[model samples]
Target: MRTVQYELMRPGELLAEKERFSVAYLPVGPLEWHGPHMPFGTDPLDAQAVARGVAQKIGGVVFPTLYCGTERARTPQELQCMGFEEEDLYVVGMDVPANPVKSCYFPEEAFGMILREYLLQIVEQGFRLVVIVNGHGASGQLATGERLAREFTHNTPATVLFTRAMQKLEEGDQRLGHANISETAMQMYISGDSVDLSQLPPREVPLKTCDWGIADALEFQGLGNAAHTVEQDPRDATAQLGRRYVENGVQRISDQVLAAYAELEPRQGTKA
Candidate 1:
C-alpha cells in the first residue's frame, strides 16, 4: 500500500518498493474540450485514475499524466463544413475562444518521438514493463503508442503495453463518447464535483456526416462529431453507470498489465 504515484513518492519509499517497480504506468491524453458539463481535463484525469487503480492492484508506480496528445484532424473542408473559421480554432494550450475549448496538440511524428523517448527513459529507470494508457481515442495517438511499443520492445529489454481505455470494452457494451453519457458518468464517479449535469445544453446538436474514408464512415455513423461532441445522450448519465465503466476499465487494464508482465518474466530474469 505504498504511494502509487511516482512523483509523490520519496526516494526511500521508491527504494522500498523497488521490487514491485518492475512496471510503470504512463497515462497519456489531451487537454481538449469536453462540454459545458465536463472539465477539459477529463481525458487525462480518467486515464490517471484508471492507471492508478491498475498500479495499486498490480505492483507499479503511475507517472504523472501526460496532457499533450495528437489532435483530431480538422481539414479545410471539414472546418468549413463545421462553420468554423481558421482563427476560430485556437492553437493548442491557448486560452482563447473563451468557451468550452482547448486542445494541446503535437504533430504525429513529434508525438511518436516523444513517446519513444519516454519509453526509453522508463526502461533506463529499470522498469521491465511499461504500460502506455491513452484516454483519447484518436487514431493517430493510438497508433503512436502501438508503434513505440513495437519499436521499443525490439530495441530494449522493456515490454511495452499500449491501449486506449475505451477500446477494451466489448462492441455492444462500448460507451465511448466525448462529453456524453459514458464519459460524463465516468467523470462524475471519479470526481464528483467536476461535472455539472445542469450545464448540459438544453437540446442536442446534429453532427455533420462525411463521404470519404473510414474516419468519415465512422463520423457518418455518429462516432465522430464536432458540434454535438457527445456520442450518446447525457440525460441518462449517472454516477452509478460511471462507476461501472470505471471498475470495468480498471479490471480490463489490470488484466492486460498482468498478462504483459507475465510475458516479460524471462526478460525480467535476464535483466536481474
Candidate 2:
C-alpha cells in the first residue's frame, strides 16, 4: 500500500520522503545461478523483498536491487574437499563452478569501487541515512561492503548501515547458505510459484552430489567442517516458514536501522 521504491516515486514525492526520513535502502546481490530448481535472481530477489519490508517499517526509499556483487574463488584443491576432482575447473562464489557462465561477479577491488560509488551517489542524492541490504554472503563481498560502510560514515556526514537480508538467526537456528532451505523458503514467500522446489530432485538426492546446486558440509584447509554453509533441506521449507524468516529479518534490520537513524543529526532538507 505504501510506496518506498525510489525509482517508482516522482521527484517531488521522493523529496517529501527524504524530508520525512532521509534514509535510502540499497539491495545488493549478484546475478549468479542459484540452482536449476531456483531462479538466477534469487539473491537480489531476497534482498529486494526484505529491503521493501524494512523500508515500510522504518520510513525510507528502496532502490531497485543492485545486481553487482563480489566473490572468492575456490581453487581445484579446495573444491576437491567438496567432492570435486583433484585438479580442474575453478569455482567462484557459493561453490559454483566457473565454467562458461561462472556467476555475475566482479573482482573484489572493482566491487569495492562500485560500492563506494553507489554509497557516494546515495549520499549525494541527499539521503542522510543509507542502508545496504546485502543478500550475497561471499567473504569478499562482505568485506568490501563493510569497508565501504566504515569509510563512507567516517568520511561523510551521512551515516551508512551495511547489513545482510538473510540476517543471522538465533542460536541453534538453521544456517543460511547458497540456494539452501532458508533462501529457498524466502524465495517461495517472495515469488510464489516462480521458485519451484519441485524442480529439485526427490528427498533422497543429496545436495552435495549435485553439480550446480548447494554444497552442503564444506571443509576448508584451516576451517573445520562448515555444515552451516549449506544446511537444511529446501523441501522441508514452506511459504509460512519463508514468511517467518523474512518478517524476522525485516524486524531485526529495521531495529538496528531505527536505532542508528535516531542518533544522526536532524535532516537539513535535500541538497539543491
Best by TM-score: 2
Candidate 1 residues lying further than 4 Å off, grouped into runs, are 74-100, 167-169, 203-231, 268-272
Local accuracy of candidate 2 as per-residue lDDT tens digits, 140-200: 9999888888877777878889999986567566446567777788888999777877777
Where does candidate 2 have its weakest 10-residue lDDT segment? 221-230
True-vs-predicted CA distance for residue 73, candidate 1, Å: 1.8
TM-score of each: 0.80, 0.88
lDDT of 1 by residue, 28-124 (tens): 9877766566777888888888888887887788888888788646555544443345544532222224444445678888887777777777788
lDDT of 2 at 243: 91
Give the poorly placed runs of model 2, Cα more than 4 Å off.
Answer: 75-80, 95-101, 216-231, 266-272
TM-score of 1: 0.80
Clashing pairs in 2: none
Highest lDDT scorer:
2
Question: Distance from true position, residue 64, model 1, in Å?
Answer: 1.1
